[model samples]
Target: MSKTSLSLALATALAGIVSMPAAIAGTPSGAFSIFKNCPYTNPSVTTCLYNVVSSGSFVIGNTTLPITSPITLQGGLESVGPSPLYDAVGAPTLASVPAKVPGGLLGIANPAPDWPFPLWVAFWSIVNSVNDVTATIELVDTVQTNFLQALYPPAPDSGEDPVAARLTVRVHLQNPFLGGTCYIGSPQNPIRINLQTATTNPPPPNQPISGEPGNSYYVWVDEANYVGYIQDDDNSLVDNSFAVPGASGCGNVALGLPIITSVLDFLVSGAVNLKVGLPSAAGKNTAIMSGDTSLAASAYVLASEQ
Candidate 1:
């Protein structure tokens, strides 16, 4: 017998089949957007997810390289997290708050019999100083898979699968400044985001490769070098190109809500792009690949004044 998870109310809601919320008057109802895959009231159709693959070439100084295996990403269905789409800066904190987040929320879930998906939070920064962009990305893979996983059940299953390696490079702005140093994590560290059903991601690479999910990475621009790069925990460089950020004194998240809107949202309001066939120090744009990661999310405007 599989152990049933979710409260009776939540399960009832799931059984009821909740439809996408309708759009507001002038707010441009987001209901019909791309995020309709994960509906709060229905779990059968919750197949929303994402993958990371190399798309094309990225040039830096005089070097370029092809994207290979070992660098990847995958989430949705089996992986989940707090992705509450907010327009504020410094939303989540990195301190004691993590203990407060719902556990086992960022990976594939069994749903019943056994919910072994432990609670975890992914904290990384996508900084693009060249283009002046930064995002304290927090992907809380809810481990909320389909009810079928639970129904069939796996013997001591972690409930997570290999989501192809993912890496998204966007040329944009920077994060909110504080006291002289800056970092990602909106509202505050250990923030809670998985408020509703969301499923959005960058397009897969034009080709194929291998990698895993539930990994960590961070990218930033070298002001001294005036270029972008991806770095792993070992301080190893991942990519030759990355997005840039708007510099310090670049303004901040909002003074206290309404009056001050975060540039993080405003800057990202633009497109996440990729380019190929650029000059490089490697004689060839070897850094160029045929894959890309869409670090995007689906959201709906519940209420609007307009």
Candidate 2:
């Protein structure tokens, strides 16, 4: 079959599974079952994407959290422009599902202070008991993301390797002690993570790091049709030069008492920043997402809808 015909056939098969029907929200079956979340109704959408970050580590300043839970990223890419700007308009559908920060608050670099003081000692004692605290990195804005940059391998450049999957994110710290509003970064002052699937050249204090696109192979929808390719396990997205803001609103809540809540918020925020090394410099932090990625044409997805 010709490239155009093959592309259409491949997209048709993939889209058949992804954009089956708006009425069908249940689980999808078959080889293309993984793309169940593709937004078929969106006319502007031109690409279907599903990626799972199985294992990786995010090092922020003094803390290093291993990815225990899988991080899922799924949605459609709009036919806005070219390359990375394809999703720049028409209400982009890409969504980055936040994953838990492994060990939660206990996973931080320094859970307790070295020198035991009066107020600090009391704080640490209480914090140590609150083992349910967990942190999750959430995307602050989808517009700040670059899908193409993350999807394709980087090219050799005379200049620095640009950030891949460039995203603005905030870390939500959840715990009774920290409160629901507690966050390491905010929408206004988010942590900008510039991930890349290539070698990084960060500033001082951070050494260079590398990433890979992993094994690539095309999917066969059937004997006569060829679907989009899949980036199997081993794909790595890395960045070691992103700044992290300090924690805020920690323990900030009106739990029947105003004074107690204010005090708790202050104490918790201070402790978290001090231990996690908040407001860290660009070179002091790192993020690596390793997973499998599947892609299909949006045209086919929409065609399947009809």
Candidate 3:
């Protein structure tokens, strides 16, 4: 069959399980409580509000208010409760160095606070006011792992290590809003992002071959990963209007890119195949596998409806 004919047949077969729909913005239930001239102090009050938002519940007080969007909170909001906990935005630099080694066995880095996970809820401004809002919450990783591994490879036996690997999660908001972007820090580590391996670099034999010398190994993280979210706590909820040209959500008032959460990983080994998996709350978890070679790797946001 011709390439076009083959492509058409394949698409028809896949249509049973896959559906293509345009992204839709989420609507708020008319149950939010509004206070007039109320001071935003009281940790208990904030905690209550956070619980309502997180639990998908709401209570509106005596006021003539229109529920423009769902009440939402990002990172964490402080409340009146004793010893209130907060969510962390970006990954903080390691006060001390983690374990390091040469080729063969390898250690995957821990997830950064800013690294996008499955359960993260992203918010964007629709009215520019703190009250007017839109939210894009994701409970799963949308990026595919196989695609990422194909694009960037991990370490190789006696080969160079990956310079870096990054994952970015974006939330598209439909309205314009001011002071609507907020980040939360988790009191307990609530998210898990990790990499798993299939084959490790082979260890040297007790006795070296007469002609072959024992190989040495080393791993190095990409400088970009270090600067992107690790070294800099520059987590931001950017306006869609200011997105890079020719990129997603540019010059479109109907859509705004609020949160950009990312993570980077570096590895050193001779192994040809490696797989990485992000923490998930539902569906078949996704994974990326590095076939062979040593180079930078990356995964974009997993696209899904709220």
- Give me the candidate number with maximum lDDT: 2
Q: Give candidate 3's whole-model lDDT.
A: 0.19
Q: Over 4 Å off in model 1, which ranges?
A: 1-135, 144-174, 177-205, 212-268, 271-306
Candidate with the greatest TM-score versus the true structure: 2
- What's the count of clashing pairs in each model shown? 86, 3, 32
Model 1: how far is 40 from its true place, Å? 31
Query: Candidate 2 has which clashing residue pairs, if any?
Result: 46-298, 164-195, 178-251
Better of 1 and 3 by TM-score: 1
In candidate 2, what are the lDDT values of residues 1-306, reduced to their tens digit? 333443454456555544333433343345545555666456656666667788889888787777777777666665311323233223323344445554665554233444224445444554577655666777667633344445454465746344556677888777655568988889999988777787888887999998876765556544343334343457898988888888888753543333465566666677788878887988999899898877666544333331
Ranking of predictions according to TM-score: 2, 1, 3
TM-score, every prediction? 0.18, 0.75, 0.15
Instruction: Give one digit per residue, the lDDT tens place, for model 1 in 1-306.
Output: 122322232233333323434444442123222222223222222222322333333333222222333233333232122222221112221111111111111110112212112200101111221112222233432222232221222232444422222222221123222211222222222122111111112123212222211122222222232111111121111222222222122223332323233432232221111111111122221122232322211221112112
Task: Show model 2 residue runs off by greater than 4 Å.
Answer: 1-29, 79-129, 143-152, 158-161, 227-229, 252-263, 302-306
Tell me the deviation in Å of residue 14 in model 1.
35
Cα misplacement distance, residue 150 of candidate 2 (Å): 4.1
